[model samples]
Target: MVVGATRQSRFLFYVWQILLTAALQGPIKPDPGSQLGGDPWPEWSRSAESLASSEIEQECRQSVDSFLRRAESSLQSPLGSRHPNPRDMLFFLHVPRTAGRTFFACFLKQATPPSKRCAKSYDILRLNVSVEGCGLLSSHDDYSVTAVLPPTATVITQIRDPVDRVLSAYEFAVEVASRHLQVPLGVRTPRPPGKPRVDTRNVWPWSLLVPWMEADMRMRAAKLRSTRDGALKENNTSRREFVRLRGHAGGWAYYHSLASGASKEELSQGDVLLPNLDPYNNPLAMPLREFIEHPIVASTIHNGAALQVLGLTNYSHHRDAAKLRGCVAEVPSVREAMVRVAVQRLQGMYHVGVTDRLQESITSAAGSLGINLTGPAWRGKADAAFEYGDESVAEAEAPTRSDGPYSQLIHLQNQTDAILKELSRKQKELEQLRQSSYNSGSANAVSACFSLRALPASA
Candidate 1:
């Protein structure tokens, strides 16, 4: 995809060169033998990456803008009598906190037969794109991974309202943490050991995240209940109280309560038992506000939709990668550029769906891909479907207060909200087109090109 070539800014031209020479040619796909588990959490760092020089950053931004424009323009061409083919590939870009799991189970699995669906890549980046005849791949992987796919591959994704997504992510994180931190389901054998060992094998991708959230919530809770003299109130704290806080209160208590009767040696290894604990300060409880403002959480939930689409998110493929709290969107120019590019990509993708419009999206996507849905589609509620170890958590609910503490950070959602509006508009236009075709008794399949007008570069 190439943007206009006439009287282009020097910054835009430099970006175009990079995109044409590198992105267009695509990166070489590595051998499938190097597959490994996906790294959701890297080492934590207090400092963020320093911004590149103004000129350099500007050039990169312009390059992204130019490429997106070209991509949108390329998709504006009319559709043909093409039908679903066995050889065609489908990539479900499963954005987090969206009803992606539900979509996969209800729509994707139903549309693409088992023979053609690839093994789920939600926890691994190494895909067997070479020999596997699978037609579908879904994961929480960022846009950078798309470079591995062939140009003809169909890329589809579902997005949610930014505020709702952030809230859902928090609720899910707390829910997962409570399960992992709670008592083991089966009877436990007494350890014959010098040190208590934590299980680090076959762990979930959210393992690191669980500990981090626990520590943060504990810290927040402690602070809230602290004395005026800056001391935590720990008077007669019993094991039952600890259990209640850890289990029912969503894991918002200190790691080892005095009443639990943990030994000195066991207490010494508390860091191992619960990673990311601040040894200097006792932990506190967290409500939704603190969760939103926590540096790690802020980096993730703040403008996450745009960042994930632009492939600038901190979820690296390598465990050793330097972690960054990506606050680059704080810069006005960068934010605009990112949103513009993301909106363009969303408009141009093989299929774009919104969480609120699940049934309609499924119907539209099924029509575009020339596949029939197995049954009536339905929207999956986050609270109802969120599960732990095959058992449903009994009382999970996302925060509902619109005037909550997270309202202050609502500005961060501006870009994503804009993208949502654009997507809604596209969906509406597509529906109208479909209805007009039906009224005329045309047998043509409504094309996947939802938006014919590309957003201007200046937009």
Candidate 2:
């Protein structure tokens, strides 16, 4: 009944009807008592006539409420109390820029035995690897992964503040772009000592986007230097900063000549990707604020967490064109519906973690998977801290004025922040439930459960 109270909720309710119809078409094991024998076509007309719209809505609402209650109870159950199927796999749906690397290294690998871990993959949509006998599968893929996984697979993931995630992703792209350009041209401009370079040219999305990023940075810097004032401004910055920057020195001249003939390379990268329904422009070339507000970037990642959760972020991989908008819907009503759907899906997950609360998140996930979280596995943050030089570019490119671009990004942040809030709430409830079970002497008590404080820093 409550589901039909608002226009947006009503729309969601209607969408559920379509979804239920789609689900019914699938091969579901039928209950012996619920099976209908003869031709049911004639009965359908009578049933539709007899069932009022209000009654249909009420039934739908009851079914949804029942599901929600079941999911909540599952979360509140004592850790390791629920008997999962022997074949039930735990899948980590890794969201980009959510400290997933750290989670995989510090908690996931340490807790689960190597024998049970599935090889990590990003393009799960394209690959057809057998996941049989693997207790854990983690990837940078989205919710569509459930298609290949068993029905009983327990999905787990971490959520982060969208603003931070986007900023981190942008910085990461810049770093990768810098490496790709520098590595091949290392002879012309040697990289600094001890600063490692990775070859991400073979990686997806990055393989597609990083080259464009390099081209964008090169062209922008060349254009800037071409102007008298821009050349004067460039000389004012420190030599070290200028050298380390993406589009300085030989890069400008290189891109300038290439730009005349570089349209082909640029055009290749612009082929319509799911989120970027349109061709990508020189997005990385824009200022930070402009970059955030760019149509391609905003549509793809404005509410990335929810979009990823719904499997709408990678639309090209999936065939459900009607279901996959491939980005955060621009319509306020549709976006609201999307957020609610994402939250509902997240609430039903076996373990939902928050990037901000790393320790508690790890504890809950470890508890759910019945991992002992001790011995050589109990390590403090495996992620490497940023070097001093990495901060140099941040200082130089700091924004002095902001007016409109930030408003849109801030709004986008609010949307993903809602998803983060729901995950945080779930984490708290699980912790409380575990603490209660421990107090009641119903669950086995381990000494200093998940003692992360004592572990030495990763070498």
What lDDT score belongs to each candidate, Candidate 1 first? 0.48, 0.46
Give candidate 2 misplaced runs (Cα > 4 Å). 1-86, 123-131, 184-209, 224-285, 315-317, 321-323, 326-330, 376-459
Please list the residue runs of candidate 1 whose C-alpha ends up more than 4 Å from where it truly belongs after superposition.
1-84, 184-208, 217-285, 316-327, 374-459
What TM-score does structure 1 among the candidates reach?
0.51
At residue 127, candidate 1 shows an lDDT of 47
- Report the lDDT of model 1 for residue 76: 67
- State every prediction's TM-score relative to the real structure: 0.51, 0.49
Best by lDDT: 1
lDDT per residue (tens digit) for residues 1-459 in model 1: 222323122222222222112211212222211222222222222122344556435534544455456445544641112344776567787787789877766677655556566654543333444434556777666654554454456778899998878766765655554433232322233544543232221122243344565444433333333331133235333332221112232333434432343323233322334333221122322455766776556545667777667655555321121121122433466556557767877776778888999899888988888775665444422211212242221211221112234332332343444456467779999999999979666433333232323545565
For residues 294-393, could you state the per-residue lDDT of candidate 2 as single tens digits? 5435434566777667655532223331222421232344455556767877877778888888888988877777777775663333122111122111
Worst 10 residues of 2 by lDDT: 392-401
**Model 1, 38: alpha-carbon shift in Å?**
12
